[model samples]
Structure formats: C-alpha cells, structure tokens
Target: MKKAKITAYVDAALFDEIDALAARRRVPKTQIIEAALASFLSPDSAEQSEAAIVRRLDRLTRSLERLERDQEITTEALALFVRFWLTTTPPLPDDTYLAAKAKGKERYGGFVETLARRLGKGTTLMKELPLDLPGSTDPR
Candidate 1:
C-alpha cells in the first residue's frame, strides 16, 4: 500500500509508550500511529464503544435484580419466622422468670457456639436439602 508521510508533535512520554507498544506488537511506530488514527477517525468506533457500555449495563442490571430477589427472600423468611416465634412462645410466670432468664441466656450462648461451629465447618441446612424436592423452584 502507498503511504503518505505526515509530521506531528507528541509528548515524550506518549512517544515512549508508542515506541514500547510498537516493540511489543512487532510493528513500526508509524504503523502503530496509523492504526490509532484509523481507529480514532472511524465512525463505527463510537458505536463499538456504546455497544460495550450497553453490554456492561446489562450485566449490572442482572446483578442488581439478583440482589433484589435475594433481599426479598431474606426479608420474607425473617418476617415469617419472627411471626411464628412470637405466636408459639409462651410468656414466663413472674416467680420463675429470673431463673428462666438465666437458663435462656446460657442456652443462647450454646446456640451461638453451635452456630459458629457449623458456620466454621461450612455445614448448612440449605446444603442438606435436595434440589429435586417437590414444588420447589429455583429463584434464580
């Protein structure tokens, strides 16, 4: 191909970078400059960039949707469990309340220890449940 020569001023750092890229790509610095100019002048360059940005936005939207779904599930589960617990638990009689409070504290500490142990061992009830259970659909 016939090529026309042109002269332009460039910063020393940018020149060095172009020189490095040319060396890495096994091409002349002029070729590198020409390719860069071609890309910069091409009308499709902006469209290609916009397409990339759109793809990124789509990924972000999907991620946000998954996050929102997980949050909803957590909120519903917590509300239902709290409601069930409030309904099922009986109020302690005044005379035995102090002793019962102490026992409850001890049980809570034991529960925390057990929970920590299970978490440390990576054991969870969700993991034990079969994926093929009846009427179960993956939220994902």
Candidate 2:
C-alpha cells in the first residue's frame, strides 16, 4: 500500500515523548505516531473505553454492597448481644463483687483464646448463618 506524507504541529514535550518511546522500542517515530493516530481515530474507541469503565464501576458497586451488608450484620449482632446481656444479667451483690470480677476476667481470657483459635481456623459466625435467615439480603 502507498502511504501519504503530511505535516502536523504538536507540543514540544509530546514530540520528545514520541521520540523517546520510538527510541526505546527500536521503531521509527512515524510508526508510533501512526498507531496513536489510528487508535484515536478508530470509530469504536470511545465505546470500548466506556464499556471498560462501566465494567469497573459495576465491580466496585458489587464490592460496596457486600461491605454494606457485612456492616449491617455486624451492627445487628452487636445490638442483639447488648440487649440480651442487659436483660438477662442480674446485678452482683457487694459481698461477691470482687470474686465475680476475678471470675469474669478469667472467663474473658478463655473467650479471647477460643475466639483467636476459631479465627485462625477461618471459622466465622457468618459462615454458620443460614442462607434463608430473616432480614438477610445475601444471594449466596
């Protein structure tokens, strides 16, 4: 195929960039300029770019939704635990207060250890929850 020659003016910095890129790739500067012009003038370039951006946005939206759902689950679990603890636990008498505090500390340490082990094993309350649980929006 025969090629046509045309003169065009570009920014000095852009010219330098094209020169550098051509040198690095061991190709003629005209080749790089031709490829860049072809891409810019392609009919479907804008649509292809927009489609790629939309795909990324869709992925981000799904990730954000999952984060929101996880946050809701965590908040609900904490609220339920607090309500149950407040209603069921009786106030300790002054006579047994010190003993109860010591026992509570020991039990808390055991609970922490058990929690660590479960986490290390990748076990989670979310995994144990039924898919059909009330108020759950999880599709899995």
lDDT of each: 0.87, 0.91
In terms of lDDT, model 2 sits at 0.91
User: What's the residue-level lDDT of 1 in candidate 2?
Assistant: 79
**Each prediction's Cα RMSD?**
3.4, 4.5
Best by TM-score: 1
Q: List the residue pairs that clash in candidate 1.
A: none
**In model 1, which regions exceed 4 Å deviation?**
1-5, 16-28, 43-45, 121-133, 137-140
Displacement of residue 96 (Cα, Å) in model 2 is: 1.0
lDDT tens readout by residue for model 1, 1-140: 89898999999999999999999999999989988999999989899999999999999999998778767766887899999999999998999999999999999999999999999999864444335557776544
Q: For model 2, name the residue pairs that clash.
A: none
List, residue by residue over 41-120, the lDDT tens digit for candidate 2: 99799999999999999999999998898889889999999999999999999999999999999999999999999999
